[model samples]
Target: MKRCGVGSKNQAKLQAVASVFAEVDYDVQGFDVDSTVSAQPFSDEETKAGAISRAKAVLEKDVEIGIGLEGGVMQMNDGLYLCNWGAIADKQNHVFTAAGAKILLPEEIANGLHRGEELKTVMDLYTNRHGVSHEEGAVGIFTNGVISRADMFIHTVRLLYGQRCFYLS
Candidate 1:
C-alpha cells in the first residue's frame, strides 16, 4: 500500500480522506499543517485555493501522497449553500482537485451568516451544538444524518483520486 498524508489536524476531515484512500490501497496518516487558507465566504475559487494550499504545504515530507480539504459557502439564485473542496498532491507536487456536495442553507441560517458570523460559528449556534464542522457538520444536520461532513469530504477526495488515476493509467 502507498503512504498518504493529509494536511489537517481535524479528525473528521482526516478520516474523511483517509477512508477514501483505504479503498485505493493507501496507508493514511494526518498532519496538522498551518495552511493559512482564506475563505471568501461565497467564492468557490478561493475555497479551492485553500485546499490546494494545504495539499502543497503537506508535501514537506516524502509521503507518496498528500490530501487537503476545505469547507466554503456560496450564494446562488435560490439561496446560499455550503461547499466542500479537496485537493491531492503527489510526491513531485502534481496536484488534482475536486469538490464535495453542497447544501442550501435555510433562510434563518443564511440570515445569521449575513450578520457576519462564520459558517462554523453559525452552525454551532443554530444547531445548539459545537464543532459541527469537525463532526458530521452542517451537511449531517441538513440531511438528517443521511449525509455528513466527512461523507461529503470523502466525495471530493475520491474525485481527486479519480483524476489522478487517469494520468497514472
Candidate 2:
C-alpha cells in the first residue's frame, strides 16, 4: 500500500484528510510534528511558506507522501478570520497546496483576539456560552454552523490530491 504521512496528531484533521484520499487507495498515517512558522502567516504567501516548512520536516522521514495542515487568522477591515491551508509534498519534490474557506469575525471579537484572547473566551464573553470555540461554530458566535471547517479541509485535500495524481501518473 502507498503510504502518506500527515503532519499532525490531531485526529479530526487526520481523519478529514484520510477520508478524502481513502477513495484513491492510499494508506494515510498521522505523525506529531510542529507545523508552526517562524513568523505569523496571515497571507497566502506566508501561509504557503509555513506549509512548505512542515512538509520539508516530514520529508526528512523519507515518506512517499508528506502532508501539512496550517491554520492562520488574518484581520480584514471588518474583523479577524480563519484561514486553513494544506500542503502535499511527494518524495520527488513535487508540492501541491489547497486552502480552506475563510471565516470572518466580528470587529469587536477580532480586536479582542488580536490582543491574544482565546477563541473560547471571546465566544463566552460575546455569547455567554461555554465551549464555543471555532470547532463549535463555523466562524463566530454570530455565524454558527453555517459551514464545517473540517469539511473544507477535506474537500481541499481531495482537490489537490486529484490534481497531483494526474501528474504522478
Candidate 3:
C-alpha cells in the first residue's frame, strides 16, 4: 500500500482526502505543519507559492504522496470572496493544484472581516448565536440535512484525485 501525507490536522479535511484516495488503494496520513503562506494571494505566483509551501512541508517526510488544502478570502472587483485551493505532490517533487472555487461574501461579513473580526465571530454576531460549526447542521447545510461543508470538501477531494498524476489508473 502506498502512503500519502496530508498537510493539515483538521480531521474533516483529512477524512475527505482519505476517502477520495481510498478508491485508488492508498493509505492516507495526516500531519500538522505550517500550511499558512498568505491570507491574500491575488496573483497566480503567490497562490502557487502558498500551495508549494504546503506540499514541500509534507514532502520532507519522504512519502509517496503529499496533499494540502488552503482556504481563504480574496478580494475582487465585486467584493471579498472565499477561495478553496489544494495541491498534490509526489516524492519526485512534481506538483499539481486545483483551481480555486470562489464564494461571494456578504458585504457586512466582508466589512467585519476587514475590521479584524474573525469569520466565526461575524457569523455569530449576525446569527445571534455562538459557536456554530461549519459542519452539517451549523452553517454549511441549507435544507434539513441536505447539504454540508463536508460534502463540498469531499467534492474537492474527488477533483484533486482526478487531477493527481500519482493515483492508480
Candidate 4:
C-alpha cells in the first residue's frame, strides 16, 4: 500500500483522512508537524496557507502522499464563521485544496476569537468542556450534533481526493 502522511496528530483530522483512505489502498498515518502559521488564523487565506504549509511539511516524512487540515474562524460581513480547510500533496509537488462548510459562530464565540483567543480554547470555555476541538468541535456544538468536525473535514478531504485523482490521472 502507498504511504499517506497527515500533517497533524489530532485525532479528528487523522480519523477524517483514515476513514476516507480506508476505501482506497493507502496507509494513512498522522505526524506532528508545524503549520507555519499563527495558531489562530483569522482569514480564509491564512487558513488555506496553513493547510498547504502542513501538507508540504508532512511530505518530508517520505510518504507518497501528504494531507493537512486546519480549523479557524473567519470574519465576514455577516459575522464570524467557523471555517475548515484541507489539502492534499504528492511527492510530485502537486497540491489539491478544498474548503469545508462555514457555520456562523455565536456572538460570544466570535468575540472571544476576535480578542486573540484560539477557536479551540474559546469553544471549550464557551461550552464548559475540555478538548472540544477533538470532540464534536464547534460545528457539532453549533449545529446541535447535526454535523461533526470530522464529518466536515471528511467532505473537504473527499473534495481534495477527487480533484487530485482527476488531475493526476
Give candidate 3 misplaced runs (Cα > 4 Å).
39-48, 118-147, 166-169
Candidate with the larger TM-score of 1 and 3: 1
In candidate 4, which residue ranges exceed 4 Å CA deviation? none
**Which clashing pairs does model 4 show?**
none
Clashes of each: 0, 0, 0, 0
| Best of the two (1, 4) by TM-score | 4
lDDT, candidate 2, at 146: 53
List lDDT for all candidates, in order: 0.82, 0.70, 0.67, 0.91
Q: lDDT of candidate 4 vs native?
A: 0.91
Candidate with top lDDT is 4
Candidate that would win on TM-score: 4
TM-score (all chains, Cα) for each model? 0.90, 0.79, 0.76, 0.98
Name the better of 2 and 4 by lDDT.
4
Rate residue 10 of model 1 by lDDT.
79
**Judged by lDDT relative to the true structure, which candidate is superior, 2 or 3?**
2
lDDT of 1 by residue, 42-158 (tens): 568778888887888888866788888888888889988888788998877689989877889899988988777888888899989889889988888889999988888877887
Q: Give the TM-score of candidate 4.
A: 0.98
Report the lDDT tens digits of candidate 2 across residue range 44-76: 666667776676668776468888876667766
